[model samples]
Target: MTGTEPASGAAHLRWRPAPLAGLRAVAPVLVLLVALLVALAVVDPGFFDPERLLAFLRRSAPLVILAAGQYLVIVSGGFDLSVGAVVTAGVVVAAELFNLAPGLPWLVVVAVLLLGGLLVGVVNGIVSTVFAVPSFIATLGMMLVLQGAVFFWTQGAPRGYLPEDYRMLGRSAVPGAEWLPWAVVVLAVVGVAAVLFMRSDTGRTLVATGDNDVAAGLAGVRVARLRILAFALSGVAAAVAAILVGGFTGVSAQAGSGYEFQAITAVVLGGVALGGGRGSVVAAMAGAFSLQALFTLLTLLGVSGALESAVQGVIVITAVAVGGISWSRRATRTHQPVRESV
Candidate 1:
């Protein structure tokens, strides 16, 4: 037995990723991030202004936060098309609540935000898990419903802007200029929580379920409940994002347009598998920052907004292919850095 222990120890060391492997996983993303920073600095040196960078983070916060939420769902074996709609729903609901009751306090508005998101999540979970609908289909339906409701409520024109105090979440930062935007801070908090969650027993069970539901069930993981929890978390994230977006940008019919796809794109870009069971929340957040940096770079380079979607489409396809097959195989076959799917 003691002799066999030596072989097992050797095997562990052999399989363990090298120190550089960590750097390799993050290298591509880091390179892109750096390239964007360099270009931004070249095109507009003011881009490096502390205030401007903080503002950019504030603006990017919603998408970044949403990407983290989307990561949880995707890594846990589900899709969440409803999040885009939920964002719109949240903004519209908050605005309407205030419009109908102009004297509504900030607390009420915050409550509305939370409640709106909870409802969407519940519906998504019930429909997806209980009705046996695919998450994609389920969320798609929710998106349409929310969109139509917004249209009907606003009649194509939104009213009741969020107050300045409420808007501070998206626009304000810590007291010191050295500190970043509040939105960025919130994102950091959520990101840290997510990372810790991933290290917990429940998180492991959830990942196990994503990897193989049938096997996890036999191992005593409540696969369905975990999936529901994942959806609920996603809905909550959307609500938080809505608060930031609406507060910062104001109420608009187009508030959450295209967010769902973008969140998915960011997740895939971070090397998280679409089908499930493989990813790090930190990497997922990095993917979000990387995407924002890419867009900022593109805009600075004079790329049309219309071209953005096309670029994103290419990214999604390329990222998935890299993570699913090419990079993964490379990561497995050699110590060379693959695509950070690890």
Candidate 2:
């Protein structure tokens, strides 16, 4: 019994996690969110009112969804720079299709937009994985392609209006809580799905691939396929975001412009590793909320809207720098030499 007790104690000690390990993964984003909320409350005492809060969530939903999708790709060791273009394409294509056939059902139009986004993702994956193009370049080229196609199709001017039924997803309120936006429902669904997906085996495998593709492949993980899947998911997310954006803001040639950076920034701010293999989808979503809150605060403070881009640039750079430093410290600790006492 004494021998067994010692063995069990040793095993327990070996298996125990570091005190701060769990907190390290998610604390930054949570702290940022709380801080933002406090600041918002201070800036506008009514910011926490149920109606206003729900409206804020609704406004932030599209970016949150986009961040979720971006999280998948980034955690898989790739970037999806074309997502903004995908959003624009989705909106433009849907509008043009509806213009061509005004009688087309909104559901059908949505399906087409989703498929188009998926197709773009597939191409991105193939180009990056199969053709050996770097993800950054492949997605960038795709962005240009999509932008050019939209410009040609619209001749620099987008036309047609999203049907009321289509707009309802973004603008309508719930039946019982008329003040609550339907977008909250969409955001909830996407958030739950993202959380579940990350907890699944495939998600773990994807993270493994991101951490070290060579090791993951040797362990029988289908790295290429997972990368492609990540990009595809990102594309689908952009499409979903586009639906909400189109419905909420209506269509424009620049409807999705700069959203790619915003999604990336949000993901980084959430503490997701840039080169992949780390971060939580929930944190990434919270990052999105934080970003929106920051923007709102800035607006209230009378910050120029034109400086939004500059602020985003600073956020991205800071997040990346911090992540890099953290990674280096971890790596140093991992590779530090051990000495035996004489």
Candidate 3:
């Protein structure tokens, strides 16, 4: 009985999660987000006012959506550098389509944009997986290709305007709460979908593949398909974001410029591992909020807008460093042998 009791106690101890594991899982980005929000409130008390907050949410929605999509590709151990270009292409193509067929319905245009985005993603996935190209290079090439195509199509000056109805998704007010932006509704839908998807079996397998493709393949996960799917979802997200941006800001060649880095920065800030296999969609969204809040605070403080790029670069570098360090510490702890007293 005594021997059995000791064995049972040891088993229980081994089975229990570490005391700080829960906190650790959410700490990186969640804690930063809270801190940033508190600081924003302090800097500008009105920042938390309902109207201003809703405005902020509206402005941040597209990037938040982009971050969610980028999260999927990143967690699967791939980068989607072409998403920003995808956004630009979606907007430009929609505008061009509208110019050609002024009577075309907004919903049909949106569907076409989504399909185009998916096609772009499939190309990225195929180039990376089938052609043995690194995702970074493949996506980068895709970005350049998209940029050139848009330029050639527009002859260096984009033409056409988004229809009023098409802009509603980015600029309209909610039915019950006029103060709330329609972008908020879209953001909510995207957020919920992302959370649920991440909890699914396919999502788990995708993460496993990111962690170790060889092992995941051995376990029967369709690694290539998941990678392609990740890119496809990312493309769809960019299209959605483009629709909102086009509506809110109107058609412009540079409308979606630099969004790729922003999404990547937001994802990294959320504590998603660079090489993949770690992160939460919720945290990535929170990171997006934090980033937008930081920008707002900076603007309120009268900082030069030029510094935005520098700040983002620093955030990406710092987040990657911190994540790598944390991973190393965890790996070391996991491998360290337990010792008994003599």
Candidate 1 vs 2: which has more lDDT = 2
Among all windows of 10 consecutive residues in model 1, the one with the lowest summed lDDT is 1-10
What would the per-residue lDDT of candidate 2 be over residues 14-105, giving only the tens digit for each residue?
A: 33234455356667677778988999999999999998999899999999999999999888878889999998988888888888899889
* Model 3, TM vs. native: 0.88
User: What is the full ranking by lDDT, best candidate first?
Assistant: 3, 2, 1
Question: What value does the lDDT take at residue 284 in candidate 2?
Answer: 84
Better of 2 and 3 by lDDT: 3
Q: Per-residue lDDT for 1-342 in model 1, tens only? A: 001112233344323234554455555555555666787889889998888887777777898889878887787778899898899888888888878887778777887787778778878877877788888888999999999989998898888778777777777766775467778888778777776676566776776777677888897887778888888888999999999988888988898998998898787677666767766666677778878877887788787989976786776566556555546654443222222121
Candidate 3 per-residue lDDT, tens place, 193-309, comes to 887787666876777888788898898888889999999999999999999999999989998998998898888787776667766777788878888877887788777889876
- Per-model TM-score, in order, reads 0.85, 0.88, 0.88
Error of 3 at 165 (Å): 0.5
Over 4 Å off, model 2: 1-22, 315-342
> lDDT of candidate 3?
0.82
* Backbone clash total, candidate 1: 0
Q: What is the number of backbone collisions in each predicted candidate, taken in the order shown?
A: 0, 0, 0
